[model samples]
Target: MSSGAMSQKMTCDKSQDRHEEKVQSSCKQSPPGHMTDLGKEEVADNGRPEKKCVEEVQSLWTTEASGSVKLRIDELCPQEPITVHQMFINCVQKYGHLPALASKRKEKWEKITFSEYYRCCRMAAKSFLKLGLERFHSVAILGFNSEEWFFSAVGAVFAGGLSTGIYTTNSPEACHHVAKDSRANIIVIENQKQLDKILLIKDNLPHLKAIVQYSGSLKKKLPNLYSWEEFMRLGLDIPDKTLDDIISSQKANQCCVLIYTSGTTGAPKGVMLSHDNITWTARHASRAGDMQPAEIKQETIVSYLPLSHIAAQIYDLWTGIQWGELVYFAQPDALKGTLVNTLREATPSSHMGVPRVWEKMMEKIKLEVSRCAYLKKKLVTWAMSVSLEANLKYSKDEEKPFLFNLANSLVLEKLRAELGFSGCQKFFSGAAPIGSDTFEFFLGLNIHLYEAYGMSESSGPHFMSGPYTYRMESCGKVVPGCRCKIANVDADGSGEVCLWGRDVFMGYLNMKDKTVEAFDEEGWLCSGDLGKTDEDGFLYITGRIKELIITAGGENVPPVPIEDAVKRELPFISNAMLIGDKRKFLSMLLTIKCVINVETMEPTDDLSPEAVKFCQQLGSQATKVSDITGGKDKLLNQAIQDGIARVNSKATSNAQRIQKWIVLGKDFSVSGGELGPTMKLRRAAVLKMYHNEVETFYRELKK
Candidate 1:
């Protein structure tokens, strides 16, 4: 699309874009500070932009946005020749003997040095070359997080192929969609299970040339299927110089990874992130959670989040590779079990989790507290109160009471140890908006929970909280080399979060139409999500612009916070969505989180009102999550009502509170088409699926 056509295409969007609409608004628009050449804009700027990393946003947000002459973080910007392959080779030279990777084998963590990691990476790349993979082509990796997964991903990049990953939870049809769309030449899988999925759908994927299993041998051994070791052996004859030649020729603008978005609105779009994106992100992300110099050198991180998620790609993979940080592969199947144990053993210097992960951890802590002795419970309650007070005071930069110091050592320190957070100086939470209460709770325990903001389109970690500038509510100020602006705005300065930077993605793979739609003529990518910048340029993501619930009174209320509040009220709720766009009052659709640990495959403790009622329904026998979620129990129904009431109590007005709610008969899941790959709620899809329920809610209101 030409620049003129792009302008016409984004006409509707510009009106809604607060940054564009209120160009002349006086919001203390300060010029950005000079920075190192690492983050300088590469593309020519036709029209004058706000600054290199500064941007126009809500007037309310920037009325006092300037804070003590903020300067760009030059130290965290990417250096020259920023490519994944180049970066990996550079690390090998700098940290040759440093432990680069660790994967589980039976019961122990097997380690790999930086040089060894590069050698394996080169072997994988050489194998891809042997398979006839080339530049502009793609590779598909299907599996959970593993060392093999990393090797394959880097191998694809080293071989000059655009590498993309498929969520392990994706159905065969979904897998086929991505594989076919990407036109991947080689597809890498973990075991028989993932291989079987490809076999079921490979017939439709003519571009798929070979299948490489990362682990687990198949006796069948189809013509195109090869063991990972066999594939690696194919490149054994290839010299290290050949791999170096490819890495040296690699360009910064080459599409390195195709990260698929969560697809909350529609089908998943493969975001084409270039080598520049990865390196820039890797540099800034390493410094996003700002730790001590010593801590950075010896940083250990437990990698358990799905590597497919952009959060994991940055937090564990890319940053680890770039900074020579030690990464321990935690089992994806053990969020609370093997992962917790591994974190304890590793004592990782850094930790990161999505909202769900942290929420589950908080829930577990509460559950454990409930089971404590009376004396223990009393002491814990007292300590938590004192600690929460101290944390809140500390957040506001106020002097903490001396008692807080005592409480931190006496209770919080031990609590951190038990939860395997003893060495975590800064724990990151992102990929979803976390509740302030949850943040407070984490802070209460003396954990530095840094909320961040990024997407596959931005590589990852574009904006994040850090030790230097901590904010519980906002994600953080614009990252060192990135520009952030609240685009489509209203009278109050809330609208789309437009982004542009070195880390911004190339475009959606094989989707030129979407590519044009993603960015404006000025080169700013209009992020569909709604947010606002604080007085100090910190970002506070409110919700998706499309998901905003505007009531009949014309009041725009973000559903995310309300829905999050509702979910927190009930331990059983897996998801919640507020519905009131042009309606008189808000209503919610509630879905249950199974009373079993899906990851650990263990039944949750038979506590909670839902479990009690479920047991009663089953003639007082112990009941499973499937039973309670499928059937309607009186006690469970009442509990849902009480939970809604609790959420509504926080609403400032009746219009804002949930007036009606229905506990859905089933959970929203990826396979069910009600949730996205990351389990993010597909609000529109859910409303359409439950059209009758929603109508009944409004129909009864009319009657």
Candidate 2:
């Protein structure tokens, strides 16, 4: 059947609503205590409260057995998907006066309300029709976050066209790969830099038609490129309602967004997410998060991450629209400046971040505390301890000790305010493994960061951690309805993680064989990650099965988890590669975090030549400062030596130790070719980069 026809045939029965546990407050009258299933003497086994089962009005939410679990996403949209055009319509109708998006233009913050946002998207769609951007035609967006970028994306979606976004940080080759692969006809690029990258390979993309540029200023000289203003002016004459009607009529199963894999295995694979796919995922996740519509007094969010990734789309755009929230897009380069000010000003109740961002925030916290008096540090530490304990207990649905909470308010409130997270109600961490210590550290500060795990193919979060029942190292319980099992276990029973759920993506776009391989004969997607579940059913992701090492001693070891542990303790460390595929013992190569001193404008000579050479020349003026000594030369020398010593001390033994390592003069990044878009190490690529060093290590061992 034709895709559109197939989508039209797909129908959702209201009886099959996946999220059945939701108690519409409008229909039910109950006290706040009647929310949670706890403290019910006459409660039914099915969790229905006999005496109006009480729900404790928690500031945050988690999907517990007693609470409402989100409905399966597939059930929500059924055959018809939730299109991007629909998101614009929903936001306009529900939150037209609210700021839909905020982006910087010419060093000033620019905002568009939900109504204006819908108008812009509609106009852009109309303009695209005028320009003949039609079904299945690819439009590639390349640049930092901006209102123009967003409008163009929505416009393309409204016109029944596929839209693909590239990270502005990506190199020309990466851009070329996506542009050519997507068969892009029209490209929206940010400024001359991104335009230049596309222009560099413009000749190579045979399908390329037009280059649309948006930025600080448009250069009149660029060839085959239309200026942002000029492009919008053409569409401005088109009525908004015309585009809206066209979008509303579009089928759900139609392609809404095209996301490319980070290419950890090889070249990027395009994953087509329909309006149904994204909308349902967002709906269920919001439900799982217990994001009640009433709780959204005024949703404010910071959208600074790269929009090319799924996390940014699901959380920033999709959730923002569904909940009638305001999204603040920061200037690409001024993330820190914008972040602190935005958080303080907006005081968003919900925020999501990768582990690294939180780590850096903690580092900043430490740096700030170093300047405070010793007594202040002691008080802060004591307060953090109390607050964290309260948070941990609170997560488990246990009441916080009254004394501890009192102590927390008296002491940690100041610390929380200093961190500019005083009003922050909920935070989520995903995309990578976060250490338990780091998790606990935030909880201690009364910042409940709900760490979850999922892949791009899974449509984002599958397992979630919240203020309850979290095992320090385990990712979290499988989000309701998602089932995970281990495959190919040894004597100890560790194996590859396989998952089956509605949140799973339809499949890689146009890659049937590849999709088949990802799933089993029974149709479960093999997550490619190595993990294990506890007796309590909590999921603990150990490592990647693909990156496992089998030592000569017949011991199979997963390296990523071990490497992750060591790296967490050493903040200066950037990347750690575990070596010992068929060797006597395990060893690793550690690279320190590289930083550029804002004042000096050069790589700080913070470590000794030997250690610096070992750590890949990770010199930063952004040191712990407390660890530095005397002057720049002295501090650099000591910092280098200290960074090496820190990593050396964190290793467990010969198997888990860094025997000999070299820090590179550079950092691993997507643009730099050392890291994947998902931030996973390109192992073979890194090994290739350090071939000589590997040879030296083997030779030294033999000697």
lDDT of 1 by residue, 98-155 (tens): 8877777666667777766666666678888888786667789999788788888888
User: What would the per-residue lDDT of candidate 2 be over residues 1-703, giving only the tens digit for each residue?
Assistant: 3332122112111211221122222113432211131111121112212221122232111211112112232432232234455544444444666777765444555666665666566556666776667567678899877667777787788776777888766779988988887778789998887877887899999878788876646666665577765566565455545654565555444456778887777888877665655665665565565454423477567777778888877877777766667777766653444476666655566788887678757766765665679998888777787777677656445678886778677877776765556766667888888766667778777776776788877777777775553566667777665678889876656788887665666566667677778878766778989878879888877788778888777677778766666665554566678787788766667654544343332334343222333334444443332233223345455554565467567655546544554445555655456677656688878888877767766886688
Query: What TM-score against the true fold does each predicted structure earn?
Result: 0.83, 0.78
Every candidate's lDDT: 0.71, 0.63
Model 1 local distance difference test score: 0.71
Number of the top candidate by TM-score? 1
Number of colliding residue pairs in each model: 8, 26
Q: For model 1, give the 10-residue run with minimal summed lDDT.
A: 60-69
Cα distance off (Å), candidate 1, residue 321: 1.5
Runs in model 2 deviating more than 4 A are 1-81, 104-110, 236-249, 294-296, 389-396, 467-471, 489-493, 568-572, 597-672, 700-703
